[model samples]
Structures are given as C-alpha cells and as structure tokens.
Target chain A: MLEIATPFVKKAGEAYLLVLQRSSEFETYTPAVNSARELLVKMDPQAVPYEKGQLGIEYHRVDWMGLSL
Target chain B: MKIILGILLVLGVSCSSTNQKVESTATTDETEIQAPAEPLKKRKTKKQKSAVVTPPQEESEPLAEEKREDPYLGVKEAIKNANWQGLEGEAQKILEQNNQNIIALNALGMAHFYQGRPLAAKYFLNKALSINPNSSDVKNNLAYVTKKEGRSRQAIILWRQVATAGGSSSKIAYENLINEFTIAKDYKKVVGAADSLGSQNVTSVATLNSLALAAIVKSEFDEAEKLLNQALEKENNNEALLINMAILQLDFKKNLDQGRRYLDRISFLGVQSNRRDIVTRLEAVAQSLTNQGEVK
Candidate 1:
C-alpha cells in the first residue's frame, strides 16, 4: 500500500506544514472531509477549538435552562 | 500494532496565506501517471484530467470578440474594457427582462467581483448557478467571489467541481486549485493539479516555487531541485523562490555555500523585503542550523 504525504493550513497568515508519516494506504475513498467547524459542534459556537478526539467523550445533558431529569 | 509518529510540522505564522480549510485527499484527482507526483508536469495519458487552479481578471482578451448578433454585447464590452459600472446597468436591464438569464446574471456577478463587492457578486452568481447548475463559467466566477469573501473551503468545493467537470473555464478552475491549495499548504492537491495541466513552461515562477516546496515535503529531493532551478530561471530575485531554494538545500544537507547565499540575498531585499512571517522564520531556522554546525 502506498502512502502519500500532504500538508494542511494550520493557522491564519501561513500554511502550517504538518508532515504526517506514512503508514498504510487507505483502501476506501477518502471521505468528504469536514471543515474544522463542521467537525465540531454545529449549533454550539462558544465551544470551539476542541482537542483532538474530543467528540468521542460523552457529556451529561445540560440545557440552556440548566434542568436535569 | 501500528505506530506512525514521525509528523514533522514546521508550523509558522503567515498573513499572506488565507484562512482556508483544506481537505487532504486526492478524491477528485485521477492520475494518468504510474505513480502519484513522481515528477510533476511530464506525462499526459488523457485530456480529461483537470486539477484545481486560480482566477482571471478584467480586460480578458479572449472574452472580447464582440458577438455581433448577441444581445448582451453591452455587458461583454464593459467586461472587456474593465468598465464594471457600464456593465451593471446593462446586466440589470437584461435581468429586468428575464431574471434567470445566465449571461446577465454572470455579467452582474463579474461587475460586482471586479468592483470589490463580493456579497453582491455571490448573490447574482448564485442566482445564475441555480438556473444552470452545470455552467462551469458561472461556477468559476462564483469560486473567485467565494474565495474573496473568505469562504475559501466553499470556494474549493466550487473550484474542484468546475475543475473536474473539464469545460471551457476548467483551465481557470485548475489554476485556482493550484493557487489555493498551495497557499493552504495542501501540497498533494497542488501536485495533482499541476500534473493535470501537463505543461512544462507556462507555469508562473511563484507556482514553480510552490511545486518545489511540495516536492520537498514529499521527500522528492531531485524533483524539488529541478522545479526550484526552473523557477530561478524565470525570476531569481523572487524572495519566496530564494527562501524555498535555500531551505531545499540547507534543510536537506546540500551545498552549504549556495544555501547561505540564497538566505543572504533575502537580507539584501531590505526594506522592500518579503515580510511574510513564515519566510522570516524559515530563514532564521536555516541560519541557526548553519550557526550550530547542524548542516554538514
């Protein structure tokens, strides 16, 4: 399996060059990758800049009114 | 068990590059070559291939040939003459007759685009797009407007769509792809786009330099050297080229004197210097490497 090297824009004003090491080539077609915002909370604007793998962490239900059953 | 941890990110700040989210995949890029980016812009197995690229400007000469029988002559002439104001009235008049007219909608969008009115440009172009979703012309124009409006990822989708479709304006779309992806530091896409173009000489100096940088990132040192040399032939004084060429040599442990000389040329640029934050940092890194006898 062939692995390709690619870089990504990390910050404003410059292309932050992230050189990921090669592992195994992905067999399936790459997904329609989401934008940074799209990958995170869609409705919640205040909760941005989340750490990697933060989405997997489950959280208790907390509404804007702050009442739990 | 797989442990792939060699991710060397030379992260630096840059204001010249835009805030664009780049997708890291060759989903739309179909290859005609045996290996991906083995050597950029050489073999061409098909004309169907298209890569992401850049936009156009006013006074477009090819767009000038007055369609004598065409009704939108006023708008066409206005664009040909860079007269955005002149086209606005004519475009609006055509829209008044039939709001869905593609020519009129495109004209209005082009006028707004050249006038630095992205919101208005997007409004008209989106209308035109809704009428003929397959129209590459409108999509390409919309991509430019979207990019300018700071919706770069949206622009990428449009550019990628228009580019892969391969129409009259596909060249422009491909150019935008190379430019945007390069700035976003999405090197694979840049290579993919450049490969699709399949031309050796027409590429600009800046583009060649970016291609070289991409090659360097891929650890294709020989290819990077060739690209950097080709760029230097076009514009030796170009600051980006100088810095990249310097990095290509210094970081890779090539000729010490030449790399140092390249960096020294940047100092000569002085007040009229390339003030890009990334570049300054790259220079500093190279300089420090040499100082510490890190580069042999």
Candidate 2:
C-alpha cells in the first residue's frame, strides 16, 4: 500500500517546520519525530521522544477521476 | 496517452470481473502508483437519452453524423489530456443543458476534487449518488471526499460497503481501505476489515499479508499464521508472504528450519530498488535468525 505517507513536524532553531507525508508509508514518522525530539530536548532539556506506535497524525488518501461520464 | 489507454484497457477487463481481480493492485509494498488506475473509461455508465442535444429539422440529416461524433468529445478529450479546468467547463456546459446528466455531474465532482475543493466535490458527488445509489464510481469518489474532509471512520464504512457490494471499482475501494488503516497504524481495524472481506473472498493477497502483519503487531500470532497461510496459498512466490512466514516460523513458531525454507524461496530479484529497503532489511534479519539457530 504505497498510497500515502505519515506526517510530522520538527523544530529548526527558533521556528518549527511541518513535514507532510505526501507519499509512501515506508518513510514513517518515528525517525522524523526522533530527530525532532533531539532538537526539542536541546531547547527544553525535559522534552520526551515519541514512543513507537500512534504518532497522532491524520492523513487523507488521494482519489483520481477522469471523464467517468 | 498510450500508457493511460493500456492501463484503462486492463482495468476495464478487471472491472468486469466480480472479484476485482487485479493481481498487480494487490501487490505489497511495491511503492508504485495505484488506483487512479481505475480512472477514465472504466466507468460503465448507462447512456441517458436526455443527455443528447436535439438538432433543428433542416440540419437533421447530419444529426446522426453529429451524434456519432460525440457531443461530449470535448469533455472526453479534456479528461484524456488531463485538463481538469477544461473538463470543468465542458461539464458545466453539459449540465446547463440537462441538469440530470450523471456524467457531467461526476465530471464536475472530479474536477472540483482535482482542484482541491472537497466541499464542492462532495456537492456534485452526492448529487450523482442521489441519482443512483449503486454507482461504485460515485460512491468511491464520495468516499474519497469524506476521507479528505477528515472523516476516516465514515470513509471506512463507505469503502466497506463498496468493497462488499462487489462492483467494478470494489478492488480500488478495498485497497483504499487497506491504505488508510496502514497509515493510521490501526491494525485492529485492519484485521477486522480483512476478516470481513476474507469471508466474501473479496480480499487480496496483499491485504491478507498486511492483515497478517497487523496481527503480528497486535501479538495475535495465531491469527497472523492463519492469514499468512491464506495468502501463501494464493501466491507462493510472493516475497512479502514468504518473509512474514519466515518471521512467524523463526520468532514465534520456534521452527528455524521452516523459516530458512521460506527465506530460501525469496530471491530479492522482484524487489523494487527505489522503495523496498524494508524487504532488503528483512532478508538480513531472516539470515541472522537462521545463523543464530534455535533461540528463546
């Protein structure tokens, strides 16, 4: 099911950036979140990493149409 | 254009089948674009008499020629050329003549959908659905809109209906369900849906394999084994199934030799290099399990 991907947000210095998963579920959210956790902890010192499973992201699948008249 | 036609031709054949037997569509982790695969002429719409525009009496001789040439040729060509705006204009023109034209309604819904307007897309799709409740095309498209609107649970219910109803686009709907569940990491719901689809024989090898993986994640080893065996019966050469079986045998079944047998069957030749690093990693894990011998 290479239909869609998971999403995550990361902190780049003072600003936070959102990374939306446009394709492929294989890329996953854990790695991205893990990196973000590292950056967050540097700033807060008490920030925690996301545990394996449910990343709290919701996704919408792509639908295609043609002149299906 | 050739590729779209060739794909449409193939999907046209698959759509005609009750099982929605698209062997390639059921493939696990191929990372290839799928579904949109069912777009274009795969829609088996009935010709509406009122959709035809009438010609004046003096020009009636060429009416047959005009009809044969297709009044909706612009709409069809716009769709073929991937011109959503053109399709939107043509569909609006058709609807201006006959408000009951399902094709125009569908095209309008699709055009709006492509243009990133889910609300508008829902409007036309619902209109089409109101005209015919049984249309898998409209229902499936509506399901996409509902999902896009962030109503995934509702979308699942709709997809389940389309999948079990057994139609041309049932396979695509079913695959969409698998995709949603996988992304959500909702393995429990996936197993539930797979069981329901399995009872109807509408589920595919990839889905069963996915269900098996889900079962494994849930620590439902027995259910995982059952699903893996079911999938293996259909496609013995499938790497996903074999790898899953190997994991089950070695880690859970405590049968390293059986695991090795399943691993031996995998060649990695069929694995897509662009996105199948997981499969490659699994190969290493299987090798490590075999090398380590029996372990608790």
Candidate 3:
C-alpha cells in the first residue's frame, strides 16, 4: 500500500493529520512505511484497509483565519 | 496621496494666524477710505474737463488699490476656492513685497504646483524650506514637486524625512513612498516602508495589497500569502483579493487544489463585471493544472 499523510482538522489551532492509502509502486514495504502504518492505526483506531487502485487523500482544510494547514 | 498632501499645504498656508493682523490692517484702511465716498454731481462742464484727467487717475487707481489690498487675503480666498490663477498673482504680489514671507513662499509654490509648473513649484518651495528648514509642510510640497519633476530618488528621500516627522504628515509620506517605490519596482523598500508603519497604521486594504504585491515581486511566497490572508480577513468578499490569492496559490505556490478552492469561493461570491477577466484567468489556470496532472 502507498500511504500518504496530509493535514486534517485543527489540533489546538495547528496542523493535525489523517492518513490515506492507495496502490503502492514499491515491490516491498519498508520499515518506515510499517512504522507509519502503526502510527496511523494508533492515531485513528477505526482505520480502513486500502482498496486496489484507490486514490490517496484528495482533500485538506486550510485554516485561513490562523493560516495553518 | 499627493493630491491630499497638496490640499493640506494649501489649507495650511491659508489658515496661518501669523499674518492675520497685517491683512486686517489693510482691510480696515480700505474700509475707512471707502466709507467716505462723495456722491457724483451732474456737471457737464466739469465732466468734459475731468474726463481726460479722470481716465489716467482711474487707470492708476486700480494699480494703487491692488498694491494697497492685502495680498494674503487674495491668497487665502484663491486657495479656499481652488483658483490657481488668482493664487499665483496674489502669492507673487506678497513675494514681491517681502521675499522672506514663508507663508507667501509656500502659497506661491502650491500655486505653481496646482497649475502644473513643478519646476517653479520646486524653486519657491526650496526658498521656503531654506528660510524654515523644519517646516514639514514645505518638505511635503517639495517632495511632491520633485516627484512631478521626475526626480523620484530625491522625492523618496524627502518623503522619508516627512514620514519621520510624524503625525498626519507621516501617513501621507508613507503613502507617497509606497507609490513611488511601486513605480520604481523597488518592492523590497516598499515592504520595508509598509512594515515600518506597524500593524495599526498598516491596516488599510490598499497598504495590505501593496505589501502583498511587494512580497510577490520578491518571490517570497510565504510572506505574500500571510499579507494576502490578512487583507482577506478584512475584506473577505473583495474579488481582487480573492483573485490575488488564487493567482498566488496557482502560479507561485503551484498549489492547484488551494487555487481551485479560492476560485470556487470567488465564483460563489459573484464575480463583479470588472473582475470577469480575473475569473477567466483563474479558470484557464485551473484547466492548465488539470492538464498537467493528467500529463503526469
């Protein structure tokens, strides 16, 4: 799986993340990818598995008032 | 800003209290003379003999009356009414009598300035400043005259001096500096000048726009974004600000999604008639971004 981390909702008026997934180009997953997966699962307990050929994260909010991601 | 500074100079000299007594004395003398005019008599013999002599006396009487009348009164009236021609004559008259009169010198400078004689304006304004080097009013006028004369570097120096002089004059100077720097394409200085005004003084949409443009010119995308965002906070529905933000995102930051988001906001805000071009440009940028993504 190809995991992408992008900013989601504000965490105390700062950037907080939501992880998304799609098909991976790599033949084998690295330790960093594994660790990110574990972190994402811990961050969002109800994480769903990636479907084949699905698009990655396509949306993020820009906090215009505070100018945070 | 230049127009406002010019108006302030005119009003400043017009309202000066230093020479009111001189003007009042002249007016009182004229009133005393006019208060004792004899009625015209019906004498045909006296009329023929007096007619020849009266022509010369009548001709010279106006010149004497003009000399005796308070030049400052005419200067004040002309300035109040925005009659540049009348101001030129009255100011010239005052200067002829006393070249050291700072008020008359200022008036003469402003009269030439309003009449589109920048060189003449500079001459008289320089004379005034020579006499009273600390007069912020004269300095401001000289700066504008210098700008009009195409000596923007000198004008910028004078404006900076006036800006440091403080008060409403400083505000005018800041505005003039912004404009001159913009024309000079010295965007770095523009940003510096705007920042020096501090947040409270730099709250206007125009100033914000200038700061943003300056940042953009320097290719400082983050600073541009901050300034644009601050301006947007003040005028969220302003189409120009929306368009600027959209362009900044798409062209400079290369953030297609953010650009599209701003474009969506602009469309929802209802594009003004004059802003149709910006909308068209945004749409073209969005299309180009989509095409680029497809190519990738």
Candidate 4:
C-alpha cells in the first residue's frame, strides 16, 4: 500500500510546530511523553489502564478549559 | 435545484412497489440485479431547506417544507451558499418542533461544528445522543467537535465506539480516528486499528507496514520483522514498504546491512522527485551506520 505523502506529514508537523510556537508554556516534554504513551496503547491495547490514564491526563493537562469538561 | 426536484418527484413515483413488481415479473429473474438502476437516477434529489438553517424535525413546519427532501442535499446547499450563519437557528427550530428528532439535532450539531463552535456543537450533539444513544451521526459529530477542541482522547474513544457499533458513518469514523491517532502520535493504536481494517481487505499491503512501524516503535523487533516479511510475501518491489522496513532496521535494530538493502530497493522504484528530503535523511542514517562500523 502507498503510504501517505511526505508533504502531508510535513504539513501536520508544521501545524504542530505552530501550536508550540504560539504557547507561552511550550513544553515539548509533555507532548512527547503523551505521544509515546499513545503509541504504546496503539501497539498493545491490553496494557495497563493506569498507564493509559496517565497519558490521557498528560494530554489534557495543557488545555485551558480541560479536554472533557 | 429544479432538476433535483424533478428527480425527487420521479423517484417518489418510481418507488411505487406495484410498478416495480410488474417490471420485475415481466423481465424474469435474469434482470433482477439491474432493476435498482432506475432508482439510482433519483439520488440527486433537491433540498428545500433554507441556506443557513438546520432542517426541522418531522412534526415541525420546516419539516413540512423539507421532510420530503434529502437531508444530505439540504446540508450541501447550506454549505454551498455559505449560509453557516443561520444553520444553528434552523436546527434549533427543527428540534423545538420535534424534540425527539435525531436528524434535526445531528444537523444542528454538524452546522455548529462547521461554524467553529465546538461547545455549542457538543451541546446539540449530546442532545442528539439523548434522543438516540446509538446514533452514528451524533457520535461522529461529537467526536469531531471533541477533536477540534484538542480532546483527541475523547474523540478517539467516541470514534472507536462508533466504529464498533456499526453505522453508516462507521467507515468514515474509523478513517478519521486513524488520522487522529496518527496526529496524536499514538502509533500503537494506529497499528492495532490498521490490523483490524487489514483483515477486511487483505490485498492492502499498507496495513502490514503500519503494523510493522508500530512494532518497531514499541521495540518489538521480532514482530516488526515478521510483519515486514508477511507484507513482502504479498508484494515485491513496493518502494515505500521497503523503505519503511529499512528505516525500522536502521533506527531500532541498528542493522545497517539490512537497512541499506531496503534503501536500495527504494532507489529501484525510480520516483526520486518527491523523496529528496527522505533520501537525504536516509543518507545521514547510512553515514552514521558507516561511522559506527569504522569505530568498531
């Protein structure tokens, strides 16, 4: 199967970069950790629930109004 | 618009079962498969709803005007006219007329989401869910708003639920979820989801590549290698798949020889025009491998 074009990834990466650039509290650590956790879950769904919850918390920690509420 | 109305009128009559039975029995069993062709022409029905307003529920006055019309057609016209400004009001009116109407609520929520009001969209979508908790449209709309609000986890959850539940939008929801997971860098989930979809279409080699990448990222080298071998069994000389497999070897496995072989496969594909930067990155990887060997 043909993988998505490189330009698509680049464009998405650029958007991600812009989000980082605009934030005063730009923390690459959080996004990276969150991304890593998400990747882990995708790789193996039956992993620890706490681990998934931890990642979910990290992903939403930066939200001004919170992710769900 | 007039043509669309004419088509709908023709469809309304042609859907008559008596005519269908007569035509079918007259044609014998050999032509039964082609009978649906007549209804296909009526697919482009006209929408009577206003440009900016959401459609009303069946009991509402707006529904009286547009109930005969196709919901998708109304949505298209609303979008085409750039009347997003009035869609919420229209949707609200429809809801007021038929409180239990799932379709009106879905349209309202979708309009609100398109108009860039996720919070409002969420409200209407939640209302839609209340009406029909299993509604695929509401779930999809809710997921969309959640994603826009940067709540990708919630979106992923909802999309997965919709995909599993099975609905008209199930495939679309699944595709979007894959994209969302990709953006979130939830590679593990992407791999798992791709695997689920892969079984549905075994001919698609990309699914194997996705699974391989996830395994590589998670440091499951054996699994990644196994999946790559499986993909190659189905396809030979697939440049992207080869490059992906090679990148995994070089980055995670530190197997320079294997990686080089994969890159060589990419070169044979002869599509260098778009892969210039990727090729450059691969060269750096090759150099690093070479340096490590020299140091050894």
Candidate 5:
C-alpha cells in the first residue's frame, strides 16, 4: 500500500503545500510519487518537491519486500 | 390836531376789541381741558378693573402658546443645526417653565454630550427617563452617555431596550447596540443582535464583519463565509474581509493554494503596516511548508 500526505505551511500570507509519499518498493512507489508531484504541480506550477528527510522525517526501507521471491 | 385825535380814538377801539377776543379764546380752551379731565377721572375707576383682569389673561396666553407649539421646538432645531449653546439655552428655558419636560431634558443631555460633558449628559438624560420611563429618545441619549462614560454593559442593555421599543429610532438603536456589543467582545450577543436585525437588513460592514467573526469563533465556517461574502459584495476590496477570507481558507478549510490566492489579492490591494506584518509572517510559514514538503 502507498501512503501520501500533504502538509500545508503559511508564510508571508501565502500557503504552501508539502507532499510526502511512502511505499514498500521503490518501483511501486515511483508511480504514486510521480502522480502526487504532477497533481501538486498542476495545482501550482511553482510548487517545489522535497523528500521526507528534508522535513526531518526518517526514511525506512521494508526488509520483507526484498525477501519475497 | 382834530385829525390826529380821531385816528387815536379809532386805534384805541380796535385794541380793546382784540383784548376781548383773546380773553374769550383763553376761556374756551380752559373749558375744553376741564371737560376731558372730569371724564378721565370717571374712566379711571373702570381702568383699574381692566388692569387687574389683564394680568391673568396675559399670563395664560403664553402658557397656551407653550402647549400648542411645543416649547422644545427651538431646542430641537438648535440641536439639529449643531448650535450647542443655543440648544442649551432653549432647553434651559423649557426646564425653567417645567422642570420635568422630557424633550427639554433630552435636548440638554444631547447638548452636554456633544460638548464632551458625559457626566452632565448622563444626569439630565437619567432625569428625563425618570419623568417618562418609556421615552425611547431619552433612553437612547442616556445610553450614548453611558457608552461615552465607558459603562458599556449598561449602555448595551439600554440600547437593547431602545431597539426593542420599535419606533422611528429603533434602527439607530439596534445599530448602536451591535456596535457596543462588538466593542465589548461579547461575540455571542453580537451574533444574536445582528441576527435579530435580519441578514437582509444588516447593511453595515462593521456589523457584518462582527457577525462573521462570531461565526468563525463558533466554528460555523459556512456562516462566516456567507457573511464575509455579503460584506465583500458591498466593499469588494475590503482589507478586513480579505484577511478573514484568507484565515478561513488556510486555518479552517485547510486549502493552502486557495489561502495563498487570497493573500496575493490582499497584497495587490495594499495593507497597513500592522496588516502587512501579519501577511508577511503568514507567507513565510507557507514558504517553509513548501520547502519542507509533506511530513509523514
């Protein structure tokens, strides 16, 4: 399952959205991440994309994904 | 010598006739004067009766005039013209005749209020209210005095009563009540009062903004938006309405992009120093969120 969260911040009377995407496999996550980026860009062409580490969130890889097959 | 004697005799006869004519004319003049004096003495007794009777009649004529024309008319006109000194004088004249005249009392109170004498205004207005407890004009004036004196709670109650009285002055009374409630930060009462005035009837931008603020505090986002929209329709570029809309979008609806659009509009419209600071801070937060991305 892929989980996506967008948190909003206010600065100088403007609101900005921060998008985060998480999944078990990088290959499986890529589509969801790209879709979310496309949606944010559609909403605001100037919206910048960033990783979870940039916002101080730890990134963890799922060990079970590599063990399967 | 004979001719000179005849001429002297003729002259002496002419002088004697002229003297007799002068004496007769003086006697006729004295008789005419005496004749009028006797009648004047006789009429003097009748004149005394009229002198006594005319005083009471003359006294009541002005009192009757006072009753018919309204003694306070001059005072009212003076107040309308912003002639404060003239208003005071006219009101004092009415009060001198009847101490309990409510119109005079109200006029005096208003004159004092305009002159920045709140205490005196309150005293006169209170007295006027005492004379006629149901007089909305007196009550409204007293409420203004109380408001000026910073007794906002009491002023609110009096204004509410005046509004409830329902007369020519009710609309003004309701407006005053809404204003006082807003200033006192009694948002609940402000909402109730504004609602009582009816949404269609609420034309004042300040009242609408107060109602919107009250709705926001209660978390009634839809109502707040509707009221803000109504006010914006009247004043399209109202800075206060724009700011409130931005807050509603960002804080309540969680729509960052929508909120940013509102902020942009506010910047384009221009803001005061204090509001500019607030907008700058909000924009900084938005930019930080944009840079940091979404937190998981």
Candidate 6:
C-alpha cells in the first residue's frame, strides 16, 4: 500500500505548493466545489458517503432556511 | 527485504562507479573461461545465458540513474498547463518502478483532481494519507478533492487543520475555506472564521462583506449597517454592499426614499441587479398604501 500511495503523496505535495504559487488567480472550479449550499441540496438523496469514511463531517449541516439553491 | 535492499545497493554502486561495469565484464569472462569445458556447445550455453542476463541488469543501472535525476520542477509545470493525463501517466510509471514512493501517489492524485475527476482524486489522495496521515499536503489535497465532490463540511474541516499547520500553503487553504463559506451564504460561520483568521493575507473587501452578511443573518441590523458603511468608506459606492444595504433598508427601515436611492444605484450593476425583483415588490407595497389612503 505504501508502494501504491507514495506517488500520490508526492503529487498532493505539489498541489499544496501550487495553491500557494497561484493564490491570486480566481479558480472557477474550486469555488463551485466549496459551495456548501449547493452541496447540501445535492446531498439530500444523491450524495454518497465519502469512501475514506468521513472523519467528522456530519456536524456541518446546512441551515435549510438559509439555503439559496 | 534484505535481499531487495542488497540488490538496490549493488545496483546503486554499479550505476555510479565507472570502473564497476568493466570489473563485472572481466569477472564474467573469467568465470566463463574457468568453467570445465565438457563440450564446446555446453560451455557456450552457460556463457550465453549469463551474458543475456548481465546486460539487462547493467542497462537498468543507467535507467535508475536517469530516474534519480528526475526534474520535480517539471511535474508542477505540467499541472499548470492542465496536462493531467501526461502527469498522471508519468507518476504511474514511477510507481510501477518503485511502488513505495510517496511523491508519485501525491502527483497522481493532484492530476486527477485537476482533471475534474473527484472520485478518482479521492481514491489516490486517501491512499496517500493512509500511508502518512501527518502529511499536511495530503490532507490539503484530500480536503480539496472532498470540496470538489461537493463535500463542503469535510473540506472545511481539512482546510482548518491545514491552515493551522504553519506554512504559506496552510494560510492559503484557510482563505479558500473562508471564500467557500462566504459564497455559500453561511454567514454565521464566516463571522467566527474571520476572528480565527486573526492575521493573514485576507482582503478587507472580502472580510467586511462576509461580516456584513453574517450580521444581517443574525438580525443585528445596526452591526450590518456599520460594517457596510465601513466597507463603503474604503471602496466608495460599492455595488454589492449598496444593493444589500438597500434590501435591508427596504425590508426593515420603512424609508422608501433612501431605499429607492440605493435601488437606483443597483440599476447601474446591469446583470447583477437583483433590484428589479425588489422594485416590483416595493411598487406593490406602495400601491397597497395608496389604496389604503383612498379608503381612509
């Protein structure tokens, strides 16, 4: 598994670096991903539980009344 | 394991020292000649078998040397260009050669993420974390993947940990979390997040906008007004704040004249003018008031 995971760890490290080097540029993809309101609506019946087991994500519920989607 | 380590040691030595290849050739020749010559064909068979095996082992040495000099800088350039297929392919090849390398896995996962394949990205990223859970980079990437998959809460948690990890990257991760929550209209969380950010590279416009929105959600109109006014003082005649302020004034202030003035400013925003809807409602309200006046 360590053999399988080593390359991914290194690439992830590069991505972390890229986030810093390219901080000023606006990303159209990331914000859409971070949209909690949209995520919540999508989560109702369609969302699958994350494969790695959610470490503690159940607590961040969407305030449904506040949802604009 | 020990045998593998020994092979690697021999391989390293053979690859580095120029004299080693000549020494191995001479030793192979001596061994072949010293073997008992039962039949010419039998002797030839033994020598030919050894010769075939030796070249492959020797050839691998140069390949390993080239791999050792791999340009890690090029990996990033590939990512910037959105050539994730090429990047992932190279990382996969490195893994095929040395399955225990962390760099390859990280790069492959990042490549998958950039390629907009969140499910695959999560797989590699999760595998990387399990190998070394303490890796801040892996954590950040996993969080990013989760966010891309529309798992904001999970992403937020990871970003929080990353931000506190004491690095330039972590600071950026924290700001990204802030921006995400702001766009989601999660103002309550934004207020706390703003305080926790303490001092970082946060922009005043983004921060004040978040705080103003948060205050409005909490029904602290006075606080929201103060924040909006402060923001306007800095960026005079800001459209978003002006529109939001007008919405608040119309809904809560009973000041039609000031509300209209603010709404009129929104008309200049063109496509962003959410005011048309509000204007229609306000007109209805005014019509109702006029009818009531006639009845009186």
Task: Tell me the TM-score of chain B in each candidate.
Answer: 0.59, 0.48, 0.49, 0.47, 0.55, 0.49
Task: Give candidate 6's TM-score.
Answer: 0.43
Judging by DockQ against the true structure, name the best candidate: 2
After superposition, candidate 3 runs with Cα above 4 Å error: A1-69, B1-83, B86-104, B165-168, B199-208, B214-246, B252-284, B291-296
Which whole-number lDDT from 0 to 100 does residue A45 have in model 4?
44
Across B40-98, the per-residue lDDT of candidate 5 in tens digits comes to 75556556656756575578899999867865567656755778888889889988999
lDDT of 1 by residue, B172-273 (tens): 677676666555544556668777754364456656665565566567878888977887797777666776666666666456677778768877774233
Whole-model lDDT values for every prediction: 0.58, 0.63, 0.65, 0.60, 0.64, 0.59
Candidate achieving the largest lDDT: 3
lDDT of 1: 0.58
Rank list by TM-score: 1, 5, 2, 6, 4, 3
Q: Compared with the true structure, what per-residue lDDT tens digits does model 6 show for residues B139-172?
A: 7777767776777677777887877886645655
**How well does each candidate reproduce the native contacts, as fnat?**
0.00, 0.09, 0.00, 0.00, 0.00, 0.01
**Candidate 6 Cα lDDT to native:** 0.59
**Model 2 scores what on Cα lDDT?**
0.63
Q: Which parts of model 5 are misplaced by more than 4 Å?
A: A1-69, B1-104, B160-174, B218-223, B229-239, B253-277, B284-296
RMSD of every prediction: 32.7, 25.2, 26.0, 20.6, 24.1, 26.5
Residue B132 CA error for candidate 6 (Å)? Answer: 1.6
TM-score of chain A, cand. 5: 0.30
Query: Which residue pairs clash in candidate 2?
Result: none
| Candidate number with the higher lDDT (1 or 3) | 3
Q: Is candidate 3 or candidate 6 better by TM-score?
A: 6
User: For model 3, how does the per-residue alpha-carbon lDDT over B146-227 read when each residue is reduced to its tens digit?
Assistant: 6666666676778889788886567667866765554333445666776666535566665666667666766777987897
> What is residue B285's positional error in candidate 1, in angstroms?
5.8
List the lowest-lDDT window of 10 residues for candidate 3 chain B.
B37-46
